[model samples]
Each structure stands twice: as structure tokens, then as C-alpha cells.
Target: MKEIIQINLDNEMDLILAHKRCMKIAEMCGMPSSFQTRFSTAVSEVARCAIAKGKNSLLVLGINIIKSTQKEIVAIITDSEDLKSCNPEAFNYAAKISGHIQYNYFDNQFTTTISQQVLSPGLLTETKIKGFIDYFKYEPPLSPYDEIRKKNIELIALSEKLTESENKYKQLANTIPILICVINERNNVLLVNESLENYLEKPLLTFERKTLTHFIHSADIDNVLEGLKRAKQNRSDYIGETRIKKGTNYIWHLVSITPNKAEDGTFNSWLVYFVDINAQKMIVETLKDNTELKMIQLELESANSQLRFKNKELQQFAYIASHDLQEPLRKIMIMLSRAGADLTEDQKKKFYFDRITLAAGRLSNLITDVLNYSRIENSEQYFEEVDLNKVIEEVLGDLSLIIEEKSAVIKVDQLPKVSGLDIQFRQLFYNLINNALKFNSGNPAVTIGYGDIPNDPNFTGSAEKYDVISVEDNGIGMDSSYSGRIFDMFQRLHERDQYGGNGIGLALCRRIIENHNGLINFSSKPGVGTTFWIYLPKNKRS
Candidate 1:
């Protein structure tokens, strides 16, 4: 078998492209760069000279055998012109590049053949890049007129083949009565028939570096891409829903892809077609809605009932807040009113000063908690990097007196920097640590640490890159059932006097976390320590 590459060296750019194609083939044949340059340069010289003489020169590159065991790269340049008047320098240059040179003259057509021996294991690795080079061969020598006639025969055959291909393609496209397109391996559009262009009410698309995805609805692009991925990954046919624009409306289509591969089993291209399923889809949806109408009505009724119940709960909450606030105010007012003119200094000091001050402080705390809860969503601020470790330090500083009183050992670990409102983070950590200390046993020990999110059943939500901040304490934990409502406002598991919280601390913590685009969760068993896990997105904000 012989290999050949044909080129019409009619222009300098043609010479260049031909040279590149020739060298690529040489490289594919395992020829070194030096040999590649030799073959490409030799062909360039002959091609340019032939073009200069105003002749339709043809160049063919292929494996030409020399001796019994010797095979070399070869370039055969033929033209229907007199070689006697040609520049001798071109042939000389080709001769120097190639080891062998010959001239064949038959019936007024002249040919220049050049061959060079390749080393052992020559062009050991053949490439699939042959399409980049012209592939043609001539076994029997012919005259200039005969060469032209043979070329004419080839041109006729090529024309017929193209016509046949177009006919078959159109037949397939028209028969479908739907949109269809063909794309190359690189997702470049190779063909689109007339029906598709008319259906889209647009000009036929430029058949290069495009796919059906180019015209697909933007919203469905992700789904189409996923389908393409699955098709390639599984190497199977793919069927998916995509929408195509027709005038102002987008019509649904059931897109189907039939992928093709090379002889070497690599992907080649996909023949994609669409079935207009818009009417059918609408029918299916209409049927489904009618069938489920009863269930939907029932669900709506249930939701309305729940909404009313929640409204009642809100009324109860207001009543409770009002009653609680009145008690504290009433205590202060009664204590002050009792300070009569005959009262002793000791009674006046204890009642008017200490009792009034205690009641006022309790009222202030409750108001502050309610205000913070309401402000979570109303206030807006620019996000910034907040140092978790620094926030922890500030919280500990505020609780310094309590820490000393309880002799609590608060261990701080390395914490991550997170993106959020700075003040919110400080309060969030403060609440968790304060609760841990308040609920601790006599010998209080609290551990604050940072960890990757552990795979726990209680954890929910997804943040790809985040930090898990835990405040674990050796405290008297409550029943597991209370964990669900642990963060509810004014929902206390213990008496207010026992825990010393208005039941707003955990709720405030939950609000702050929500503002930071994070989650707060905790776990504990009765008599065991509690661990509140705060998951904050670890964007590099600092």
C-alpha cells in the first residue's frame, strides 16, 4: 500500500497550507522534525515553482518504496506544462532535500518525483490526522491530456456524490417534519436543512462552531448540557426536553441524540432531531391538574387551618408578653408608691432603690431581646469578613465577671474567618457560650472549637465550603424532645428563675445566624453536655 497527499499549489497561502499538511503527515509517520522540515520544504519549492509557471500543478505525498526493504517519504509534483522552460533551481532544491529524484514525461505531461529514505521504525505511529492532508493516488502513468480527463472523471464523481448526499440529507430532514441538525465532534454545526430554518423563522445558521444548544431556550440549556454529558459518559442515546424559539413563543421539543464514533471508537459527532411535543405536553399537564384537583383543594384547606392556628398562637404570645411586662412594671410602681412620708430610711433604701432597680433591669432586658428579634430582617448592612476567634474573645471579655464567679474554664480553639455582619457574629457566639455557662454543673467547663461539618443526622442544609463552629459545654442538658424548640422565642425548658434567661437568647442566636447565611443546630442528652454547631460559609473575606 502507498500513501499520498494532493495539493493544488495555486497560491502562496495554498503553498503554506500544503506545506503544513505535508509536515504534519510526516510527523504522524514518526518522522522527526528535521525530516518533516525536509519533506515540507521540498514540496514547497516545487509547488511554488509550478504555480509561478501558470500551470495547474498537483502535489501528492505518500510512502514510496525505494529498494526491497527501504521505504521513504515522497512528493510527486505533476503539471500539464513544459518542464524544459521551468526554473532549474526548484528541482535542485527538491533534489537536495530528497535523496532520490526522477522525471516522468508521457503524452506532453511532465512530472517531478522526489523520494527520501526514513530510518528504521519510520513513522512508527500513524495518525488519524490524514484528513488534514489531501488523499489521492495514481497507479498507472498517463499523459497531460489523460491526467486532465482523469481529473474530470474524479470531479464528476465527486459532484455526483455530493448531490446524492444532499438529496439523502434533505429527504431525512423533510420526512421528519421537525427540527434537525448535525454537529461535529467539537459541537460545531455541520448541517441544517431548510425546514429548520423556516420553522425558526430565521436565516440558516452559520455551519461552524455551533450546536442546537445555540438556539435552545436559555433556561433549558443546563438540562440539555446535562443530557449531552450523560450521553457522552454513558455512550448511549439521549432523550430530553428542550425548548426552541418560534417567533415570540418557545415551543417544547423532545430532543433526541444519536451519537456516532470513529473507526477507532472515539466520538465523531451526533445526529440530533427534535419531536414537537408541545401539544402533547400541555395535554398531559392538563390531565394531571384535573386529576389532582381534589387533593390540591384539600391541601389548601389544611394550609388555611394551620395559618389560623399560628395566628392564634401569635395572639397568645402577645398576651403573655403583655402580662409579663405588666408584672415587672406593677412591682416597681407599688414599691415606689409605698414609700410614704413615715417610712424608715432602711425601708426606703431597700424598696425604692434596690427593688425598683431590679424590676427596671428585667423590663429592659425583655425589651432589648424583642427589639433584636424584630430587627434581624429589617436592618441591612454590607457584608465583611469577621474573625470568629476575635468575636469569641470579645464575648469572653463581656462574660469575664461571670467566668470568675463560676470559675468556668472556657477553652478557645482556632476559629475560621467568615463573611457576615461583624456584630451579629459576636452576639451569636456570646449567646451560645452564655447559655452553656448558665446551664453548667458546679464545676463549669466549656470548649469552643472549629471543625469540618461532621456527618450527623441532625445537620441539614448545604454550603459547599464552610466552617463548623461548636460551643460544647459540660452542662446539665435537657431531654432530646426539647431540642426542636430550643431556639423558639419565650419557650423555656426550665423555669425562668432556674436558667436566668427570658428564653430569648437562643432565639436571638438563631436570628443572627440567619442574617449571616448560616445555620445553628445543637445536640444533647439529659445529664450530658450540649454542643451547638454553627455552620458559617467560609468565604475568604479577610
Candidate 2:
């Protein structure tokens, strides 16, 4: 449902009544006070033009729906003749206030449509507003100039009211907290409030002749000027952030410029507002410094964690070396002591000498494993782009004799180039392949393949994706219970009579993978195959 109000604009009083009626309906429609003034003023201007051209006019007020959930007041002024009078200033001021104005001359009728959104706090009480609405509907129309004498008197009163408004505006400007100033098109200060003086720590008169950019930081002068240029060219407001000079010190502020028009409704000057944002800027700086400090703390914690891990590893190595290294030597000594001159040649050859040789070989292997395990940490420091396929091919070549003797099948897929130590990679592949061949049931066969880490069951982390390289062998695998235990130093599941190993090869692989920030995990079942999955980060040093 919509409401309509009509008023004849034949006299000054009649026109004024039309304006008041339009405003009441616009207010009933919940229009803001500012827009009510604009809409009614635009209605008066259009109705006045029709009367000035010696024509009859009627003003129509109705509630209009602009879009879904949006309603506005629509003011229509229709004239009996196509009036020649047009006031651009009135149209512009109306446009500035309501943001809408339409005029058309057709069918020997000149019509103007002025509209404004009716957004306010409350709905009109129909009973309370009915008297005002009836004023436009029931009043008898008057001559267009019947109240000319009274209009002359009101004009004189309006001149005095204008002077009082200027004083009130100045008083309002002085009371605001932010720095407010008005600058002319020439960029010279036309007026500034008392807040401006407090910001500069000087009297307002001192800034009168200087250009507005004089107080801005040199580095920020261009930005302020650019904002000014854009606001002027576009005839709108613009906001900018910059530092302003407060004597020898600089403080940041949000500078906003709004075009201020003169009485003739042309863009006369810019009303500038400087809102001090120094406290916000200081808070940001403090947060940045705190973030940097937090990052350093995180790095220190990571380094300490690595150091703790290495210390625990060293403790385990000491235990293994102290206990295991002396076993072979003690056995050798015992064999020699028991055979002192009482040993026959056959006994010496079969028992004492052979036992001594076997003990020596075990001792040698133990020492070599210990050295290799320790060297994994210290041997590599710098990294280069390494082709793993080439390294795997080279490892196969090194073990050619063993491969041929065992009649093993070696299948390798194309591998990727990774950022790592090539020597360590070769050692890693060589140890895995050699172990697979040695532990096979009869003939050895190993397959090496690579893929993304997300497909591997061992990866359980966020999407910081990694690459997976798997080495699988169809050899005699151990029980699942020993899957994690096989990587420990000297942790052999099989006796020396069955399998010959110091049990440090897998341990070395674990250290190398740890140094590269990777994971080494294996899945196995007794008498089935075992696959070792190595997960490495795609593009990181640690």
C-alpha cells in the first residue's frame, strides 16, 4: 500500500504548504531529517520554476519502492506548460542530498521526480500525523503571489538566520576533537579550528598563508597530494593515511578530505579532518617486534630439542660400544688361553685358529659399523641437487658381484632429483639393497619405487606434503613385533650363525633420514616381504 498527497503551488504560502506537506509524508515514511530538507527544498525549487514561467503546477508525494526491502519518498511536480526556467544549483543540491532527480517535458507537461530513501528510527503514528496530512488535502488554494508582502519580511529574517548559522557552525567545529580545516582550491588554508592549533602546537594564524602540504612528512607529501587531487577531480571525499609533522616529531594520522560547497552550490574548498592514529600505529609496531622475538624463541627451542635428541643417541651408542665391542675380544682371549701348548695341529686348525679368525672378523665389523653410524651425522653438512636414480644405479654396480652370485632380480623405477647429500643417498640405498639380498630366502629380488607421501600408510600429518621412497624385498622377513626394534644399534633378530651383520646398517639409515628431516618406517610379517618407506620433505633444509 502507498500514500499520496497533493498541493497546489499558486502562491508563496501555497508552495510553502506543499513543502511542509511533502516533508510530513516523507517523515511519516521514515525519511531522515537531512533528506526531508533536501526533498522538500527540491520540490520548492521545481514548483517555483513552474510558477515563475507563468504556469500552473501541482506537487505529488507518494511512498515508492525502489527495490526489495528498500523504500523511498517520491516527489513529483507536474506543470501545465513546458517551463523554460531550470536551476542547476537546485538540481545539484537536490542530487547531493537525495542522490536522485528526474525531469521530463512531454505531452505539454513538464515533470520533475525527486526521490530519497526513507530510513529512520520509527514509523509514523497515523492518528498523530493525520492532522498534518489533512492540511495539504483540505486547504483552499490561494493566488500564486497573494503573500508577497509576507514573503519579503521572511526574506529579511532569513538573512539574519544565515549569520547565526555561521557562528553556530564555528562553535561546533571548535568543539570537535579532531583537527578540522578548510583549504581552498589553491591548497592554501582558508580556515582551521582550535584543534588544529593544538595538534601543531602553534597559533592558528601561523598556518594561514602556508600550503596544506607544509605540515605533512616529506615522504608522505605526495600521497596527501594525490588524495587531494583525486577528491577534487572526482568531486567526492577521500581518506588517506600519512604522517604529519608536530614540530620536530612526526605522528601518524588518518586524513580525510570532503568537498565543501559555497552558497551557489559549486565545490569551493575541501573540509579536511585529521584524526590522530598515533596510538594504533604504536600498537602495530609493538606487535611486530613481539612477533620477531617469538620467532627467535621458537628457533632456540627447536635447536635445543635437536641437541637433546643427539645427547640421548650418544648415550645409547656409548652403552652399545662399551658392552658389545669387548665381547669378540674376550672370546678370542679365552680361546687362546685354553689352547696354551696343549692344542694339537688338527684341533688348532679346526677350533682355536678358526675361532680366533671369526672373532677378529666380528670385532672388525663392529668397529666399522660404529664408525659408519657416527659418520652419518658429521660427514654431510652442505647439500646439492642429487639424482637418486643415478645413485641407485651406481649402488647396483657396486654390488654387481653379490647380485650375480645370488642370482637376484633388481627392479628400479625412475627416481626424482632431491635436494640432499648424494654420498649419503648412495650409502642409504646400498645398505638397504645389501640387507635385502643377504636376508632373502634363496634367490634375492628387491623392488625400489617412489611416490607421493600421502599414499603411504606411514604419513599422518597435515598437508605439508612429502615424497615417499620405498624399498621392498620378498626375502625372509621377521616378526611384526621386531619391526621397530630392527633399527636399534646391535639389535640383530637372527643369530650370527644364521645371518652375518653388526645390525648398524638400518641404524645408519635412521640417522641419515633423521638428519634430512625424514621418516624411516617398515611394515613386515614373518615369512612375508618387508618394505621400508622413507618420507622426505619436498623443499626444506630441515
User: Taking the tens digit of each residue's C-alpha lDDT, what string does model 1 give over 117-165?
Assistant: 6675343334432432334344332345446655776898999999999
lDDT by residue (139-185, candidate 2, tens digit) is: 55444453553466469789889989998988888888888888887
Using lDDT as the measure, the top candidate is: 2
Candidate 1 is scored at a TM of: 0.38
What's model 2's overall lDDT? 0.76
RMSD of each: 23.6, 27.7
- Model 2: clashing residue pairs? 10-144, 11-144
The residue ranges of model 2 lying beyond 4 angstroms of the native Cα positions read: 1-345, 349-351, 378-380, 453-456, 462-464
Provide the overall lDDT of each model, using Cα atoms, as 2-decimal numbers: 0.74, 0.76
Model 1 lDDT-worst window of ten: 132-141
